[model samples]
Target: MWYEILPSAGIILTFMTIPGFAMYGLNKLVLGNGYRRNMDLRFNRMMYQRDMRLTGDPYKQNGLNAVDG
Candidate 1:
């Protein structure tokens, strides 16, 4: 039983992890440097503004209005 289960588990694990790695690779290829730069900018902004008010809109602090008032 263990012998039979091993192959099945291997196949299941292969199928599960392959697509994730493939998609991650695909995103890296597509987004390239821009994704990392944007993430770094956002991280730095958030780290510097630790005491800023939290709003429902993410772009609020970036000087973009979420709603017209």
Candidate 2:
């Protein structure tokens, strides 16, 4: 019983760790510093100020749409 359970547990752990490490590597390659900052902003882990550089209709933050306003 112990032998069967241990192998199954090890295989499950391997599957889980592989993807976690892969995603960590991908995020390191792609996102660099921005990911942490984005996560922090999302979770309210840090305070942020508006960049105020954008110029457009303030209410139209989303992409272009066909709906009549």
Candidate 3:
């Protein structure tokens, strides 16, 4: 009973995830290099800010003070 349902559920999940993955890959492929570079830069900055906050680095400030500077 349960065994019969597992393959169908797996196939359904695969179908659902593949299109979104393909669209993401296609966007990256079609948008060229500049967009990708900008995205990478933004991601790095976000990660750095998060790390700084976690480590309580005063020099790596947050909030309006950081942006105002």
Specify the highest-TM-score model's number: 2
lDDT of 2 by residue, 1-69 (tens): 568799889999999889767876786687552233343454343222222123222222344352335
| Clashing residue pairs, backbone N/CA/C < 3 A, model 1 | none
Candidate 1 regions exceeding 4 Å error are 33-69
Q: Candidate 3 on 34-60: residue-level lDDT in tens?
A: 233233688777876665566555234
Ranking by lDDT: 3, 1, 2
Q: Is candidate 1 or candidate 2 better by TM-score?
A: 2
Q: Once model 3 is optimally superposed onto the true structure by TM-score, how far is the C-alpha of residue 56 displaced, in angstroms?
A: 35
lDDT of all predictions, in order shown? 0.57, 0.50, 0.63
Cα TM-score of candidate 3: 0.44
Question: For candidate 1, lDDT tens digit of each residue in 1-69?
Answer: 569899889999999999777876776787552222233687777744542344443323444353335
- Name the lDDT of candidate 1: 0.57
Candidate 2 lDDT for residue 35: 32
Q: Indicate the worst ten consecutive residues by lDDT in candidate 1.
A: 31-40
